[model samples]
Target: MLDALGWGAVAAASLLVGAVLALLRTWRAGLIGGVLAFGAGALISSVSFELAQEGLRLGGPLPVAIGIAVGALAFFFANRAVDRIGGRKGGGAGGLPLAVGALLDGIPEQAVLGIGLASGEGVSVALLVAIFVSNLPESIGSASDMRANGKGRGVVLGLWAAVAVVCALATLGGYALASVAGGQVRAGIDAFAAGALLVMLIDSMVPEAHDKAGNRAGLVTVIGFAVAAALSNLT
Candidate 1:
């Protein structure tokens, strides 16, 4: 229970950082891109180095391959669904759907981190740090969208808090199951998460950053990835 709670708190802390970014207005496009890139790197590193390593340590190549495919497909389809629905406004309010979509998109990566942490001590702290870095861009985007749509600061913060709750619950659940699963199972799961993170990095973060801020933001995105890679190496 304590372990689960700890993971939940970590997840919430990640979301809270994102919330703070969202609530602040002076943050520039380059900074946001840098943050997103940082997150992208962290997500990639965690899945690739830590979680995937543990998963393979327990399972074999087959499970790892299957997990990667599964994770990739899940996020790919989810993204496609988002693109298809992008044209539609949400229940007389569009921002809500965007927030929900962003929140849901974060779940798989966080779950994988939770599972990694559950398996060992080093990974838990590492994932917390990684995810915290990743959540910054998300927070900025969410908060910016809300403010643009005329939502109050309270609404933005409240919505962020709600997302944090979900993140905590998801992490807790993943951590709980990590112990029952062997390395192969974990490896497979990590593969899937890795695929999902890759897709998100390519499909969302990079393009969005480029679209929003052009060349300057794009460079920061790479810097973000480099920082994350460095951190992964440190771990």
Candidate 2:
């Protein structure tokens, strides 16, 4: 259980690091785009290796499929609600989607971490890096955009901090859930995270990165995938 919290904190801390970086320097659009693309690739690797495959190994296709469907639908509706609210709140800046994506991604990601801990097989370095690396660009881009849009530093930091806290706590929740869940349920949880992550990347992160970095984003994303895939092999 402590492992879950510790690992969750480690993963979530990247948001704070990104928030601090945003306050210190203005990141270029191209730079942020490359980071987002790379993070997107890393997330892909995590979904492929750490979540989907492991989920399949745990439970059959039925639960995984069901979980994925549920997860995708959940994200779709929730994201739509957030978009409506954001539209109504007129003063919002551009990076709100990135923040929302990060917040959504982190919960299941951290929960999977907890589930892994409960299984006693240790955590996946690839998944951990995916969560951590992806979080940095989201918080940095969002915080910077917020700061640029006349928001105070405190508000930006506080917002990210809240996200981080929520994600960290999810690890504990996952751990607790794992204690009671069957193999099928665990598999479903893993699939759920992957589904949510895939939708988030397609709906928000990928498009945003492509819009900012153009052709460069594609190469950077491939590189990120290769690197993360290599890390999974190494571990």
Candidate 3:
């Protein structure tokens, strides 16, 4: 449990880094869009190679399918709700979707980390790097957006902090679940994260990137995907 908490915190600590960067810096539109595009690519790579593949291998198609459906629907509805809220507020909802995405996917991702630890793989440095690397642009883009929307530094920081803490605890939850959860349940959890992240990329990250960075976002996304895919297979 302690190990799970520690590792989870280390993984999610990037949220704080992003928050600080957004708070301190004035990001150019091109740069922030590029970062978001890169982030979308990284997440796509994660879904393809890490979560979906692992889920299929762990259990089978059914649980993975179900998990994916549930995750996608969950994110879609949640995003819609957030949009409505932001609409009522008369704007100021730029980075909120990613923050919601982090919260949604973070739990399952950290849980997978716990499962890995419990299975005695010690830790996959490749996985660690993937998680750490992928999280950076996510936080940076999200924080930057929130800041642009006139969100207070304290509010944005606190939100990310809360997300990090929740995800850290989810590591412990996953570790605990490993003792009792079957392969299918584990598979479901993995797919759930993948599914949620996939929807988030399509709905928010990709559009933001293209709108902000123009055609350059496409190549940047491919580069980010290639980099993350290489890292994913390194182990």
Candidate 4:
């Protein structure tokens, strides 16, 4: 359990790191976009190779499929609702929504980290790397937006710090829940995380990266995917 907490905290710490970077520097949009594209690619590899494969192995196709569908639909609607409420801009005026979306994205991934710990597979280095890398761009972008909107540095940092803590707790929660969950339940949870991640990449990360980085984003994304995939295979 302590191990789970430690790893969880470590994974989430990137958010604070990214937030600090954003607060400290005015990042070029192209650079931020490249990072976002790379992170998105890593996440794509994680969902495909880590979550989906494991889900298929433990619970077969049907349950995992259902979980994926439900998770995708849930995130889609929730994201839309948040957008309507003020998240439409993705930054600046949409800081709250962006933060909320980051929470939504981070929670499940962190939970999956805890789940891996409980599964007796030890830590999944690839998943941790993927989550950490993916989180950086998000927090950076969101923090930059919040700053642009006239938010105090303290407020922005505090918000991401709080999110990191919550995500760490989520990892602990998933570890605890794993004690009572069977294979099918665990598989469903994994699939759910994957589905939510996929939707997030498609709906937000990819588009934003492309908008900012143009064609270069594609090559960077491929590089990210290859590197992550290699890591997954090696570990």
- Which one wins on lDDT? 3
Model 1 residue 195 lDDT?
67
**Separate clash counts for every candidate:** 9, 0, 0, 0
Q: How close is candidate 1 to the true structure, as a TM-score?
A: 0.78
Candidate 4, residues 69-136, lDDT tens digits: the string is: 87788778877776675545544344454465567657766777787789897886766776777788
C-alpha TM-scores of all predictions: 0.78, 0.91, 0.97, 0.89
Window of ten residues with lowest summed lDDT in model 1: 89-98
Candidate 3 segments exceeding 4 Å error: none
The lDDT of each candidate is 0.64, 0.81, 0.88, 0.80
Candidate 3 global lDDT: 0.88
What is the Å distance of residue 76 in model 3 from its true position?
0.6
Deviation in Å, model 1, residue 83 alpha carbon: 3.2
Q: Which pairs clash (backbone N, Cα, C closer than 3 Å) in model 2?
A: none
Q: Superpose all Cα atoms of candidate 4 onto the true structure and report the RMSD in Å to 1 decimal.
A: 2.4
RMSD of each: 3.5, 1.9, 1.0, 2.4
Which candidate number maximizes TM-score?
3
| Residue 27 local lDDT, model 1 | 62
Which is the winner by TM-score between candidate 1 and candidate 3?
A: 3
Q: Which stretches of candidate 1 lie over 4 Å from their true place?
A: 90-124, 149-155
- What TM-score should be assigned to candidate 4? 0.89
